[model samples]
Target chain A: MDRLSVPTSRPLTRLIEALNRMPGIGPKMAQRLAYYLLRASAEEAQTLAEAIVAVKEEAVLCAICQNTADTSPCTLCQDPTRDRSLICVVEEPLDVLALERSGAFKGLYHVLHGCISPIDGVGPEDLKVRELLARIHDGEVQEVIMATNPNLEGEATSMYVQRLLSPLGVKVSRLARGLPFGGDVEYADEVTLSRALQDRHSL
Target chain B: MLGGTRLGEADRLVTLYTQRRGKVRAVVRGALRPRSRLGGHIQPLSHCQLMLTESKGLDVVTGCQIIGPLFPMREDLVHHARGFYLMELIDCFCPEGLENPALFSLLVDTLEHLCLGEGGERVLRRFEVRLLDITGFRPELHCCLGCQQALEPVTNYLSPSAGGLLCRACAPEQSPVHSVSVNTVKVLRLLREADMETVNRLNLAPDLAAELEAALRSYIQYVLERSIKSGVWLERLRREFGPNGALGGPQNGR
Candidate 1:
């Protein structure tokens, strides 16, 4: 190894390596974060480390919706005021947060954890699809709103789930696709423009 | 084109199989954002014309225009799965920067055929045979590998390791082999020589289709030294839904 490979200490090098393994964090960014943590006070460093450990130790996937939480069912699944008939399916737990922030729907959610991506070797069996099917079979869910991202893999996953749910007698719907707010019509692609027109609502 | 992966928070890394440049992976800036114009045009299974700028590591996508969306393929589960399988085969077999217009045309044609939902598994069999021919792994369907003798109408063994057919007497003890029917061999030969239109009109019984699928799938797995992910999904769909079980969606009839 060269001089550039050497860190201030072994622990700092180890921290940088660990952080570099995280998604979207390159080696340079990892090193920068590691140094930032090193310069902080001992109390601050300890608190940060404790928080990381606590997240791993305390977090559990909710058995019902598969969302990460401290409880098996999570607060959303346990909430009695939410609509029982409508279940929105999303790709990840983070999506559940995004949807919750929108405050648009009063129904519960189902986290798929991932979409069907064959290139990545991820199939439907790898997802929480069986759990979702079982949940739907309970006869409470009347409609499943597919909120999967509007990508090829996402759409394929949504279609797959919809096929399974159709035979189960539950109504399935996908989120509307069109131009985003503030998006320029001139800049939009033909597909987007067409979809926007097709999915347009009556004024 | 094939598909894309999330690069970072808002960017995407898309893989495209083009006519002149072959397989190219480029980064699309802000492609994950809701309003980015580039995101809508790069959907997998779409035939798109893209303008790319040379960069240090990966090329940057500057512009995109969809030539054909293959909308029907994306709307149906069976077509979607078959289309993905074709993309996966090209991705695995075709190396980057190698030009092969014939293979590219074969892919686009097969995708279009799948979109029409006319040929069913026949389209895939033709694709596998053509792909093998293009990649220089064309299986020895007409002759036996062991004796270099012409194959008979009787049952033959396909040796994935030997990269061809083996007669009953010549089935190699040194390597693994799969039982291939005479109809499977005849179909493979026909698929290799016939045009896409011919393949679209040609149909096989359920048992023959299964045999053809199994034989070619084994050969592909052997040549690649790995199992195809989409193949597994296709097989699962067949088992769960029956031979053509992945049909049905809002856009497709049950």
Candidate 2:
């Protein structure tokens, strides 16, 4: 009820509250960041704000891969050097980057964005799934590599997608599994994930 | 419901909407060509408010307003795999054409956990089990399904085939039951009751996680018979994380 309680800079406090709502950031960290931004040089502070604003405004979603891009088609879909026949379906845009970093895959990708989650209530329709079927239809997509994560949701999504694409008569394959370049097989699971590693024969 | 096809020389855009079978997808043609209007903004995990329209029985994504990139599942292979696994599980359990509100919110929250924190594997496992529970395949975790005995301090005996605990008296007669602690059973029970946000906040050690995983896998396998292909890869991926990172690496039967 006093002057301190009725702070003069309510807007600043409110901003901190908003920042605190972000993932991994707590009230203390948010407060510290808010203060840091406030004390920062005007140019630096303004630039940070602009960067945030720019991603929201300037960035766009590529029409093909559903990946975030500055332009429509995105770089990977446009690249001539990549293999056009292979289509790797993944759960999110970042998966493209993860596969890219592996330097193992040369094919194009389809970003499903989210997988089928039952408890939380996200079904296949909530994801970019149907477009994937359409991709198989029009594109000369010879082989579809399902790159969904190896969890229940990812497996269900992959299986559903595989079944959907099966009618199209496409060659649907999963990623190779084994002990990573340096890993153990003893700690595997009982389902297909471990079995894949156990049965991984030499190419 | 988000799906895409190669639209241009280097561009692609996907449209998502509620599907008759519970998901939908759309493509933007020529979206990848350098000169095309749709560029890097539409890749996986970009949460954008989109402008969409229906044409030729498909939902088309006309435009997008970027919200910001979510980075948790994108930062590495492990996180990526974990996220996909979570999403796919939700997909498998939901019925087509039904707008499952809890599943949708679960996905958003699951991704939020994946991107913002560590221990994604545990969070994911808990989610998987919870998904099964909600979807109605909950294996009886508490008392013995056969004996109807009160499972206090759950002394090591879960029969996947039987779908619940097997007391020592019963274990000798049946195939060797998987061993799980009372604490682990409590955790499983908790998974059945707790919300995803609450589930994500808890700690799940590797050994306990391994026990729960075996019991859960066995129960699911007994029901489904054949194994899910993704389940195998998930095991290998878990091994990749090392023992410290191993919440529940493979070792289903081993």
Interface root-mean-square deviation (Å) of every model: 1.3, 16.9
lDDT of 1 by residue, B14-115 (tens): 889999999999999999898898888888888888899999989999999888778887676777788888888999999998989999999888887777
TM-score of chain A of each: 0.97, 0.86
Candidate 1, after superposition: displacement of residue A192 in Å? 2.2
Tens-digit lDDT track of model 2 for B1-254: 23343443444445342312345556665554323333334545444455667778655667655553554444344454555555445445565456655655556666676666544565666666766665667777767776888776746587766767777677766674787788887887787777656665667665777777777777666655655444555565456445434322231111
Angstrom error of the Cα, residue B168, model 1: value is 1.9
Over A1-203, each residue of candidate 2 has an lDDT whose tens digit, in order, gives 42222443776687677787786566677778888888899999889889999999989888887888899888989999998899898888878888889899898899989986533446667898877777787868899998986544566567657656777889998775433344334432223234465576778
Which CAPRI tier for candidate 1? medium
Q: For residues A1-203, what per-residue lDDT tens digits would candidate 1 score against the true structure?
A: 63435856888888888898899998889889999998999999999999999999999999999999999989999999999999999999999999999999999999999999876789898999999999999999999999999877888899889878899999999999888899999889777788799898987
Single out the weakest 10-residue window by summed lDDT for candidate 2 chain A: A184-193
- What C-alpha lDDT do the candidate models reach, one value each? 0.86, 0.63
Query: Per-prediction TM-score, please?
Result: 0.95, 0.47
